[model samples]
Target: MIGFLWETFKIKCLGGLREEVAREVRRHLRTNSAIRNVPQPFGYRMLKRFYGKGGLLSFLLRYAGLYAIIMLGCAAIVSLFPNWVPKSGLNSDRLPDVQNVTSYFLAAQAVMIGLLFPVALGVISLITQREDASSTVSDLQVYYSESFAFGVGASGIALSIVLAIHVFWPAGYVLEYLGFSDAGTYFEVVLLIAHLLWLLVNFAALWYFLVTSLSFMRPAQRALMRRRYAALTAIPDYLTVHLLNHRYIVRLAAEIAKKVGWDKAKTALLFGGRLERGEVELNNKALSGQVLSNVWQKPLMWVIRRWLKRCNKVEGAVGSQPDLDFCPDFRRPLSDDGIICRRIGGIPLDKIERFVVGQSFRFKAKKP
Candidate 1:
């Protein structure tokens, strides 16, 4: 009796789960716009075109051009007069203290470098096919955002306390009590601390800007953005699911149904009575015997099986031809689309052959 109850409960749970999955699938199909008509961003379109046909040399040239532009802008800014620098600390007519100016420059550079470094690392890692780099880059964004906010808040509070002490109490007397021999040393220490605080503030402000901008996006838009980011940054493990064919998706659904302990007939219904190869054949004796013992259930099951067979015939007819024309320009040796063509157009054939041979030799050598 206990075993029978457990089996019944399991069957109900599986049925409920299948219903939920079918509902989500129907919802997605209804809401998603026609694929060809979906508007894409200019930047994404440009990237797709570039990666489609651009070689390694083109990639290097593109980044080099960007680097040159950034360097030129930095040089132009640094050539300005010293007086242009903000006078937050002290008003001195003489050329601002070299140490203080240099410290400020270093702090500013550190903030910019810290923000850009992770993005560059992620791009390079994607090109080199490193999954670990993608994970690191994702974590870096979260870490920097949180750390910057906390550091700036703590530094601001500390600075406020110190200023209050200097304004109300005798700061010089306090310094003397602490055994500071010279005013220059004390001022230099204060200058260093100020630069550190400035750096933290800059980082936190930029991070807040990023967060604020992203917060404006709707939940669905944000999810789509993250999915695209993940696809671009990591090797495509499930690329076939996005291709023009529905057979692969159907087969995947069938496998999932089997894993969840669905019997053959229920699995067939889930997949519209069709496997990847052909229609599933039902055992008449089993269906009429123990499986459909109730007289009412027998008729309902017969209708369901007939409906599944019709759906399978429709699906088979629709999938008889290739769904989309294969574009030559978008081929990559490691991608599913490229596998069908067996060629990488932009890259040199000799280089491709040499890389394949080298990989094969290495594999053979690794085998005992």
Candidate 2:
């Protein structure tokens, strides 16, 4: 029973915890995808939602409320360390007061955030936009714009609260309430830690945001996309013409490949399972001819017969023999053989009696 419980904890409980964490991370990423699309800064969005642009007093009140909350939180934490408050006229050896210095530092941060906002917006504006609304490039635009605004706004808010604490009222009077040794020093230490952490996190975020933006302009990835989508440009504007030319789909595809400088082999591979570099998530669905399993054979045969009859390729014959017994590999479509599609594209077929077999044929079918 003990062993069973241990196994359950090891496999089920621990494993579930990891799975839950991963699921939550994915959910957060999806949430960020939406958040990134919101272009406005936090302050603007809040103002817009709660008060009209004309409400100047409401705007001031909003920040005042924010400051009040910050002070309450400070009091809450400070209350835990009862002796945190220093006595009045806590003499200092240095000429420059720490409170004044801290305020100046935080005020500088507020100014810096203000400066950073316009520059970030400008740099983001330089990102070339796609004409298509449903484009990955556009998605990136949304992500950068929203994240930048959020970062700047958050930095501004934090700076404001920190500045206010120093400038207006040093959080609750320094009284030895908790009576812990050097409680006043602990409070000063907390302030220093907060300052260091704020600088560290914000600067790191800024560097990361800028550096990652450079990787977005990948020329090779763009070229691959150009090759992929150049075919869409071939689409005729008229619906009737498009429908008529649908029969020539293969030829049209070939034309696109040729236009994009793909050879016959590369053309065959244009829609094949991912063989090209830089495919992040390649899906492996059946491409080209399907497996003729026992369950599928009868229905497939009927379809083939109907299609052949329509094409006038088969007539009233006594018996029509197809090499159904011969097996073609169906191990996986995204394997190395996937480049050949296991049908055509230079894949050879097994020969049965009176069957003609030669070089591998290229099958045009793609995964359904």
Candidate 3:
């Protein structure tokens, strides 16, 4: 009885955990549409679609143009105030004094915070007007845009604090008290450090936004593809079309592979089996000496056999295969003139079915 319970726990309990995780992932994908609809940055799709002609020019106009306008506008504002703009460049023998450095930093921060308002508004507009209504104008989108604005705004404020400490903290007085004669050199070092810090902070903010945006969008894209696949399947007589298309067949094959583990499903199809009865009869000839000539391969074969054993023992262990009602003809025998007999994308449907529905040939695994 103990052995029986332990066996059940390994086959059933662990399998249940795996199923729960997959279901949660699917649930997240189904509900989170913002991830799917967020725009890709850097005009990546545009570049791909229109590579040779004006793609580069178009990208620059759309993205870089706005960036340049913001930056140049800030510079223009600073240039207007000759007193605020630093007269001496970083390479000059006499570095800009603390007052000049502070002035320039304040001017840049003002422009950055000012630019964020319009950018946030644009993000909101983009989210609310997306073609997929399901993904648009949700609380998540509002939060995403608002959070981005807040983060960028906060970063600008933080830059101000850093600059204040690095510039006006009297580092020269402290260096002189420490017996350093070159106060200008020490002040120059402090200014250089402040500039580097400012650049670092801005770069970090940009990187954070890019990474989070991409991460949010990737799962949404996968979910969208799954929805598309589901829609394609809903069309009557689409199975044959899917089987006929190399791309569709490959995609369908991958989905089925995930549903039933590749090795177990492949074995069931190749050797033929009645999984419900916990007996997967193997073709001895298929596992002949020629296939097992390499001694190292024997361990892998043993592992495969063990996995198949556990799979058979587990009740309702088919990974994610849909109900029979959904695909009534999934594993049905091919008619003499049926499309299954025809070669698709260089492989016959009969051969493809072996991996996809081979395990479902005899009995459906009880749905857990």
Candidate 4:
């Protein structure tokens, strides 16, 4: 029993870690895809189809919330350390009474972590929406516009501060190693300038990374995180798209298309022509051939097809032959009714789940 429990615990832990890794992978993929599409001018115009203009106040409130939550989290963690926050400020050098103050602070931290963590996560999730929604445009516009510029400016300022701090409060060992004994004026200035430039470049890289991270967040959430942390604000939208596309939706779409048919537009329209122009001509020729090749097939197919042709029903045929398998994929058209068409023909019942069925293959409703 103990061994069994141990094995079960290990499996659960592994599952949790796997989820975390998958999440990270998805984030990175979304970022990369966003970056690749950045240079395409017309794409931005196309993105407008996704959403309307975003409001400023709602956006501000989101970030403000994020800032408050993070600060609260920090406060919680710090509260645990008695030395950091004493029960009283009079004895700065001495640690706070561990027994007296620790329990209260720890309890407060626990409550804050429990309450704020979920709220922060929800706000953060909005900041970086994974779903294809209207909000994407507003989020994207901010990252490419003011947020990105702010990152660059902030990075520059940070770099300058790092340089000043490093140079003015120079460590004696580092200065002496560089052969600057407070005598070599010109050489020291050159070294300082070089070091400053290096620092500036590093800061810029850091800024880019941060701004990109913000891409995953909603504009309001990003704003709040930025207000609180003063970190990067840019995010790679492509990465999110890419991750989601591959890991979930698009992959499923592709699999369904491959199983049923490649002509997405034609399938979507529930029409005869293929999606691509060349394929349309080819499909037309094939239809003509299908009519001629088996004169009895269409009539037989038509008779069998009529069973499920009612206002709300499914219809199809079953055959071992390859071509007749096409009709099996079809079903009665969908309308105002809440029903979805379902049928299985040449394929086994177990395998039918993989194929899309309905009026339009793309508008799949259920497992059938």
Report RMSD for candidate 1: 25.8
For candidate 1, give the lDDT of residue 90: 23
Candidate 3 Cα outliers beyond 4 Å, as residue runs: 1-98, 125-148, 164-169, 178-184, 193-197, 200-368
lDDT of 3: 0.39
- Residue 30 of model 4, lDDT score: 54
Give Cα-based local distance difference scores for all models.
Answer: 0.35, 0.39, 0.39, 0.33
Off by over 4 Å in 4: 1-147, 166-169, 173-193, 196-368
Query: Of models 3 and 4, which has the larger TM-score?
Result: 3
Q: What TM-score would you give candidate 3 relative to the actual structure? A: 0.28
- Give per-residue CA lDDT, model 4, range 1-368, as digits (tens): 44346434533432222233345754554566543443333532332221112233432343345434533443453446434432322222222232223333334334433442344345346646667675565554444443233333333343334333433333323334543323222223334444444344434433443544545455565665333222112332343334433433223334434544433432221222122211111111112212110011222222223322221132232222111112211122233322222222222222222222221222223223
Best by TM-score: 2
Ranking by lDDT: 2, 3, 1, 4
Q: Indicate the worst ten consecutive residues by lDDT in candidate 2.
A: 353-362
Give the root-mean-square deviation of each candidate in angstroms: 25.8, 22.8, 21.7, 22.7
Model 3 lDDT tens row, 1-368: 44346534533433322223334444554565654454444433322222212322343343334434433443454446545444433334553565576667767766666665665666556556767778553434333532354545555665555556655545444444544324335345445564556555554554444443444445564354334333322221243323323322233334433454554332322111112222222222221222110011122233333444455556554343211111112223222222111110111123333333322222222222
TM-score of each: 0.19, 0.34, 0.28, 0.21
Task: Report the poorest 10 consecutive residues by lDDT, candidate 4.
Answer: 277-286
Please state the error at residue 307 of candidate 4 in Å.
61
Output the TM-score of candidate 4. Answer: 0.21
